[model samples]
Target: MLDQLSYKDKNTFLQNVHTAAILTYLAALLLLPLILAHPLYLLGVFLIGILAVVVSDAAQECLPFLVMGIWVAVFVMILNPLLVQNGTTVLFYGPELPVIGRLRITLEAICYGATMGVRLMAIILAFALYNAIVHPDKVTGLFSRFAWKSSLVVSLATRMIPSTARDLSNAREVQQMRGVNFSSGGFRERLKKYSWLLEVLLLSSLEGSLATAEAMQARGFGSRRRTCYNRELVRPRDYLCFLSGLSALIIGVYARFAGYANFSYYPQLDTLAAASDLIWLGVIILCLLLPLILSWGWKHWPYLRSKI
Candidate 1:
């Protein structure tokens, strides 16, 4: 699916950038969201996640996961308040339940849950975008330069996700053709039908694994020092991008450690009003957005040059 949607023109900055730079950029993205607890900052992270999905050309594949993330977020918002009954500002009172005495839904708990939900959604979207942009073969080849055994393991692990999804879809289509009505069935019946689907998928995976093993053996995969046919060179622009990402990561980490981006929601929601916080926020946003800017600039360089 990603192969089908990927841009035909392969001369973009993102495609040319060193894998190390890409890894650094992704690491910063994944870490910044986890460190910042402020709702506004979290919103920035969420927006970055959305931007990543759009830039990666995997929005169609990511939509379902985004919807599922929303559902999970709502579930967390509802469930957290029940489990954690802490806070002064009570919105409602509930009957005393066994094992847990009194139950009250407070504003703090709700806020905490919402923050947690947003954090989760941002992380999921970020990873989805990463998966779309970075192919398993690229990762495998990257690791192969270091350790062939590790490379093989990473290859299998990364390929398993898309392969399993594809197999499941194919299995469902074949089953439907054979008069297996998965949609129009009771809970038990649906479960049974899905079990058969899983069985078929498992068989398909085994067959693929066998074929892959045979191919690897035929190619003498581990017999010699592995060499990549297509090597990505780190250009001057790649250095600039890597340095920018590293600097952003350092600043973001410093801000987090210095408590500039900290927010509390347990007993009461607390936020810092220092001017430095806002500056750090802007820096983080720029850091997250730099790649998109570079990609778009390279994408339209010819058109921009024509005007000059």
Candidate 2:
């Protein structure tokens, strides 16, 4: 259970799925949030993202990101009403300030902000799910065929996030052992204590990077004589996933072009999608979730594999 708290991929079917296949599905999953502005549609998309995280066993690992995204979404919700004053229905009107002018909040701005918030949450959860299932090594290797150094840098940066958190935890423990009390201080004093931790974290990160560079150099990394490693091969299952993902992607793109996925919130809010429009959204979601459905069946009904 403790292992679930970290972003380590388990030997689950979703985790073992071909990287390109999963990425194709991921692209389709992200497409809805990017083009759609209907609050209900975006909310549905975000809910699917949450479901994916739960199904992929990423709810725990992605908890921090979920919280952060919510905060950011709330910030958008609050900031938009203050910044934008273009709406037919005015909710609040405050006295004018010098440079900022009058403060006005409207239903349109509020609805738009909420829609944007939902969009952001959906996108963030998509990434959180990807990080949970996809191995950094696979991502690096996949892109390395094109840009080795750039891929390596990106992979390193992604991996460093979890390791850096662990390092900070270790540093906190060491400080506690040395009679340094971090939680016993007031706000300002606690900030000072945290500043100390940051200093230690920075130094350790720099030293670790230097050591990695030295080790790589010693191993003749990037040399012409470097040997090939075992490569990830695509199976029939991967191809199926890719096809389903492409199907979903095509549907989503068509929906956007048909304006079935867009909503208007400025001046006045547009009515939610009609029942006919929702059919496309439903199909897109079904296609996006095909991998999870397959994995569930594969895991729970072992005899099905024999038929396959």
Candidate 3:
């Protein structure tokens, strides 16, 4: 993510795809895990998002986020089983703690943890893909017309995360050279070591904020009326991408109302007895893949690019 964005020089399909279409595509990607709790469905979407990162040639830019997501999800998965004692299928009856009584790990609890982890992974992938393909300026321009402040905030956040991560990494390395072992001790010891890292990160963030404020003031951010120098143009295939995203959203809402996407792991995992979700899943996949498919097609076929 710290790598300079090279999306423009590539002349890939994503750069040509409409921003509205991409946002809608992302909307569908983000909508699934919120309303549905099934792990397989969520995993399917997450895998496809990874494919998107690969196809968009953003592996370098997006992989750190993917790795970070995996770490967080794994932490959640491991932590959930230790805390929740719901479910009949006993996996492990852990030791008693002071405040939290006996730790009873069950199959249902594990499944629920896995489901939650996968849901988070899917969400992270969606944001990573957005950061990879969509230009920050594009996002700023797209939403600025309706919600300038919101767009500005979103744009800054999207741009800031990678930089902040890079800063944290550098700070860690510098501390290591100074004999600060971030990974060599027990949990509490390591936590104390990180205090210095956190301090450095906080200072770096403040410096970045100051720089941003200065730059914005120099740009006349609040001096006068704003103008969009680079407006997006919606093309024919762009409409198709937009429509596909809207269709996925409709299908998802319908599935939610019909209870096709609902799953529970408390009593036990829900039986995969119904095939109704298959049809909706197919629609969702198509809608999810449409922009990517079109982009791939346009890139491979010069004639199609002329028309799309």
Candidate 4:
């Protein structure tokens, strides 16, 4: 069942999406604040990047909820500049509200929010790619070695949401076929009508849970330690890929501290004029090109491969 929910090896579109998504997260984490001050700018970059990656991935299955989850996390955590609006300089006056009074939008707050947003987006995209590409069985197997009960619970819980959503959609279709009018109603009525669907879906899930528990108990599922298949091989390509990601992360951190890439909001000023920006930009370009460089080296030079 876990394997059935996992990405197939033939899903190159998913692989490409995963790659793009990962790169987008990494680059945005490393570059967004270097170039932009507004939280909206970071959000725009993330939206465009996600759209491009997912469209490129173009898998038959639609994971709209997962995508929505990403957005929800972003909006709640990173997009709310209101939480961190503190600086000596105020760039603009936000509209006055009854309880909040006139809000001040500071440059520092904007940059702060943008940075936070980029960081949150990075984590979300990385996990989203992992979920989209990596097999859940593989993840379960990996996690089980560390903590079996916790791993299984998390895996099951993660699987549960999608499964329930699928069941709900099917239930709605059946209700529609049975002459139930879901569309021609007020918002409250529409919601009230869906209660029937939700009830049945919950019942179905409860049954599934019972069946799964029974099947597991019968098989003595936890009596012995579970074994995992070694499907992921560590090739030279993987090492190069990992090293490149590491380099990007490190360079980003370095640039942040060194003032090559920075964010400031004080006395109504937001500028990045450090000399390190040029040097680090070159370093980032090299880091991004490392994969192609190593690939080319592998094909053309046999003796030079010792360094790789």
Candidate 5:
């Protein structure tokens, strides 16, 4: 799926960064979605997420996910007002619905819903960025350094998803060539036809698993200490990145505790803690943009000398 995106193979600073640094950065990004409830802060989070997506070169792959996230936000906005009947100011009243009777939409509810929706979107985008930047193999290998057996299980599970997807696509194409119409059929007919395709997928997966087991056994996978190829060296730059991420996380946590990042949507929105928040916001923005800045600077460094 990510292969469809431009810059899938582009060498970026992030690709060379230590896995620990990436994990630290992700942890900091993940915390923002959980703590901040203000619309402005959520919007900031969303923008940072967009920046991450762009830097990771996964714009094409991110579009569908972004659309789905927007749909989810819309769904939350519509549904929240129906279920939640709190707040004083009512915008409009709707006719009594089946299960939820007497729907009353209020300004407070709408604002609250908007906050929740944007929070959801921000979280999704953050993970999408992480997925684009971090390879699963590298993650498994990192885990293997600490716990080999657990890493092996995770690696197998991760491999299964894409492998199964590929098998399904191949099965669909072969079936289509043989005039097995999966699309233009009655509901029951399509169900039966698709069931056949699923059956093929299952069989192929089982066979593949068995073969993998045989190969592992033949190679004596568990007989000795497993060695990892492609060892990543931890450079000074990686240490700097990791330290910066850790500092940001600590500061963010402190800010949250100090109520600098607090926002309320119910019973009228609370006044934004502008002074402290702006400081925290700047820190987050710097943390997020650092990777992009480094990558761009590295790419253009040689060209910079010609003009100089």
Candidate 6:
């Protein structure tokens, strides 16, 4: 059992799948409220994604993982604020464009922007967590079970983007040291900088790809039958975990839409007086963090009791 649960095996992969599946469902639930009404609910969901990313990448030693996490956070926090423009009350006057009026920053708009940001964060975190935890080769093997060529392509693509991004960053550093101004520029200048960056990155990637191709050819990459180094066994615990996560997600979503998990902001946002509503809120919070609770209890119950 210890060997089966080792980092060399499928335990981490299963955990990632469990997380991805749960987050995907959570994102779906958040999306409905965003579409129907109450954009704040959507924002709440996105906040959860940010939390997941922080926790998941807290110990990632790889440069690519760190870079991706940073990028994800920036995209959600900064870019998301620009897109959403809805609110009941206008808080402040934003800049006016040629066509758009004096943009007023309303609570609704901020909430909407927040929702968009969080949604993006959640999806990106899910993918990043999967990449961090699951072996690319194991992913390919799982894919090969269904379609070998397609699986191989997907696994390679997933691994390649981050590899290429790192190479681009390194090349940019070299160019910067050689006195190329990547930062000192207007919008057009920035575009020019990126063009140069792309050129260098493409050249580097072409060389890297040629090397990879040679390595693949030497190792019989596309041969009739390819053997994998690690074999992941799908266990009962894996199924149980997946099922529970899925069930909780589905129920939570249904409850959300059915008005059971609904929160309001018109009359009041954070006023919880009634016992029934409090009970319902408790259920929602529990479901939202069910995965976290299960993982923690399983990993630390004895230690927690000892401390107590």
The candidate, 3 or 6, that scores higher on lDDT is 3
TM-score to native of every candidate shown? 0.78, 0.78, 0.75, 0.60, 0.84, 0.53
lDDT of 1 by residue, 96-166 (tens): 98977788999999989998999888877766665556655666777778787987887788678767888
Q: Against the unseen true structure, what C-alpha lDDT does each candidate score?
A: 0.76, 0.80, 0.81, 0.59, 0.76, 0.54
TM-score of 6: 0.53
Candidate 6 C-alpha lDDT tens digits along 118-206: 54544555455444455556546666865987986786786676677688889889888989887787989889878988898889888
Model 1 bad stretches (over 4 Å): 1-16, 157-214, 303-308
Q: How does candidate 5 fare on TM-score?
A: 0.84
Candidate 3 regions with alpha-carbon error over 4 angstroms: 4-9, 147-228
lDDT of 3 by residue, 92-194 (tens): 8878988779988899888888889999988988887776777768767877988888988888887787788889999999998998877798999998899
lDDT of each residue in 56-133, candidate 4, tens digit only: 352333254346555765675444556555786677787876775777776666666555656556445544545555
Displacement of residue 106 (Cα, Å) in model 1 is 1.7
Backbone steric clashes in candidate 2, count: 0
Clashing pairs in 3: none
Instruction: Judging by TM-score, tell me the better candidate of 3 and 6.
Output: 3
Structure candidate 1, residue pairs in collision = none
lDDT score of residue 303 within candidate 3: 89
Query: Evaluated with TM-score, which candidate comes out highest?
Result: 5
Model 6 RMSD, rounded to 1 decimal: 8.8
Per-prediction backbone clash count? 0, 0, 0, 1, 0, 5
**True-structure RMSD for candidate 5:** 3.8
lDDT of 3 at 70: 92
Candidate rank order under TM-score: 5, 2, 1, 3, 4, 6
